[model samples]
Target: MSVDLPVSSPTWVSAFLDLAAEELERGSAFWAQVTGTTLSAVRGAQHEFTTLVPTDGDDHLRIQRRDAGGSRVHLDLHVPDQAAAAAYAVELGAEVVRPEEREDGFVVLVSPGGLSFCFVGQRATTRSRPTSWPAGHRSRVDQVSIDAPGRLLAAELAFWRDLTGWRLRRTAYPEFHQLEVPSSQPLQVLLQRLDDDATEVSVHLDLTTDDVGAELERHVALGARVLASHDHWTVLADPGGLRYCVAGDPPDHDVPA
Candidate 1:
C-alpha cells in the first residue's frame, strides 16, 4: 500500500517514561529530581498519567502508570491534526493498537518495527526548555535513541523521515542515523541499527551532560546503577531496571560550561 506523506506541519515531540503502576510514585519522584521538574497532579481514568512540569519552556515530559508491559520510554508526536497524522503513520506502515478515542483526540500506534508512539492534536502551548541542570549539575534528558534490528533499519529510518520531515543525516558511526528535529522542539530522536538478530524495537533516553563523571555520581545517588562505561557514553539502569545513557554534549545543543 502506498500512502502520500503530508507536508511537514507544526509538531511537538515529547517523551513519556512508562512504569509499572506500583512504581509510578517512585519513578515520578526520581525523574522529577533528575530533570529538575515538579510532578503535576495525576490524571487519566486510573490516575495513570502525570507530567513533569519544568521550571521553564513547555512540559515535554510525562510519566505513565501501565498495568502491563515493562518499563520503557516512548514518544508522543503532537501535530495540528491527530487523525491526519495517525493516517499518515498507518500509510508509513504503523498499526493502530488502540482505536479508542480520547477527549483530547490522540491515538496510539506502533511503528513497523514495534516501537509504540502516539499522534495527538497539537498542544496549545508547551513549557519545554533546554536542559538546565541544578546549581551543581549540567545534565538533562535531551535525546531518545531507538534501537532497531539491522534488517529493519531502512524501513524504520524512512518511516520516521516521512513522518516528521526532519532533516536526516548520518553520523561518523556507520550504524547511527539521526532525525534532526527543529531546535525549537524539546527532544531529538536518533535511529540506531542494532547488531543483532532481534526484530523488536525499543527505545532508551540519552542525557547530555557536561561532566559524565559528576552526572553518573549524581544519578547513582538518585538510584541508578552503571551498567557499562564507554569512551563517549555510559549506560546506566534506572531503579526500575530501564537502561539509559549519559553522554557528552548533544549535537544540536550547546555544551554547558
Candidate 2:
C-alpha cells in the first residue's frame, strides 16, 4: 500500500550526537531509559534488564511510552562531565531536555528528539566482559530503530546523513530506510512512511517477544493495535497510539557470556 512520507531535507539544521554503548548496567540502563531514573536494580538481572519505582508525579514511567518506534535506538553514551556534555550538546545543536544532575555518579539527559542518554561525572569502576550469542538468548541491545513519515524521509535522512556521514541502508520493504552509525551498540535509525501527517513525534520502548502474534493478542487485551509487520518483526501501537515492535528475528548483538 502507498504511504505518505517526507522526501525533502530541512533547509536549516545543525549537528547531532553520535551515541556509543557501554555494558555498564542493563537494569540501570533500562530504568534510565524507561523511567528517566538513574538507579540500578536492587536485586535482579544486571546485564540485560533494569527496574525502578515511581515517586512524586513520576508514576508515568511504567505505562507511558518512551518513543514512537517502541524502542529507543539512539546511542547510550558515557561522558566525563554533565556540564561539559550539556555545553557540547548545545554547541552541536541539541537543545537541553534535562539538565545535568548527580545521581549515582551519573547525570541523565534526553536529547531534543526524546533520545534518552546519560553523562557520567565519574568513570565506571569496572567494565563488563563481552558475550557471544547462542541461538535465542537475550543479547546486547543490537540497535534502537524509529519510524518516521515517509514524506519526511529525505529531510530526515539529510539531517542524519550530514550529521553522521552514514549512508542509508535499504531493505526489501518499500516503507522504510535504515541508517547505521558509529557506536558500540548495533544501532539503526529507521525512516518509515506514515499514513497520517497528524503523527509527529516517534518514540517507544521495545520489548523482546518470542511470538509477535501472541504478544499482539496480549496487548490487544491490554489495549493496543498491531501497526505493521515483516518476516522478522511486527509493529504495534499502544493504547495511547505510541508505536513499538516485537521481533521474530535474532538480535543484532551477541549475548554476554
Candidate 3:
C-alpha cells in the first residue's frame, strides 16, 4: 500500500538547547549573544524554558534546562494537530516518551534512530534573517545537523525526509544527506553519517557565516573552544558544553551533488 505523505509532514519549528540549570543562564546568554537574539521570559514549572527572539522574525530557537543531565540539542516539529502527528510518528517507527498528551499539545518521541524531538501544536511562519555584525560579517544558526552512526544513517535519513516533507537530496559527500526543506522554513536538517556504528545518534546546530574565519574568532571570544577545523566548517564546544559548528557554506540553499 502506498502511504500518502504530503499532508502529514510536520513543520520545523525550533531547536532546543538543553543544558544543566547551572549552565542554563550562562549558555542561553552566550547563545543569545552569538545568534543576535534576545531572551524571552523564562517559562516552565521549574523556569526551565526560554525563547531566543529575533528582532524581525518568528522564533525558531529555544532553550531548556534540566535538573540533571549532560547538555544536548533537540529539534521541535510544529503540526496542525500534534496528537495526530504523534500517532503518525509512532506509525512511522517513533516511540512515545511522553505518552500522555499535555494540554499544550506537546508530544515527545524518540525517532527510531534514537534522536528525541517534540511535536508542537503551534506554528512559526516568519523565517528569521541572518544577522549582520558590526565587525563585518553575517550569520544565521539555521540548521540542525543530525549525526547518525553509519549503520543507522540510512534509516534515520529516510525518517527525517518523510517527517519534514522535505525534498531529500544526495550531497557530494557520501556520508551526508540533505533534507531540502522549503526555503521559507526557518530551519533545515542535515543528516550526517558517522564512522562508528556503535556511536549513538546525536544532534548539533550549524551556523553559516559569510566570513567563517571571522565568525570563528567571534565564537572563541564568546567562550567557545575549537574542537577541530575542516576546510569549510569548524567544530567548537559552547560555553554550556554543547558542541556546534560554524561553516562558510553559502546560503545558496543548494546541497552539492
What's the TM-score of every candidate structure?
Answer: 0.90, 0.47, 0.92
Instruction: Estimate, for each residue in 9-71, the C-alpha lDDT of model 3 and write its tens digit.
Output: 766558899888889888988999999999999887777889999988689999998787789
| Runs off by more than 4 Å, candidate 3 | 1-8, 100-102, 197-199, 251-257
**What does candidate 2's lDDT look like per residue over 206-237, in tens digits?**
44544445445655655567878767777775
Give the top-scoring candidate (TM-score): 3
Q: What is the lDDT of candidate 2?
A: 0.41
Best by lDDT: 3
User: lDDT at 133 for candidate 2?
Assistant: 22
Backbone clashes for every candidate come to: 6, 25, 0
Per-residue CA lDDT of model 1 for 113-225, tens digit only, reads 99999877657354344455554546667789999999888889998888887768999888899887665666778899999888688888888877777788888999998
**Error at 60, model 3, angstroms:** 0.4
Q: After superposition, how far is residue 53 of candidate 1 from its true place, in Å?
A: 0.8
Q: What is the Cα-based lDDT of residue 86 in candidate 3?
A: 79
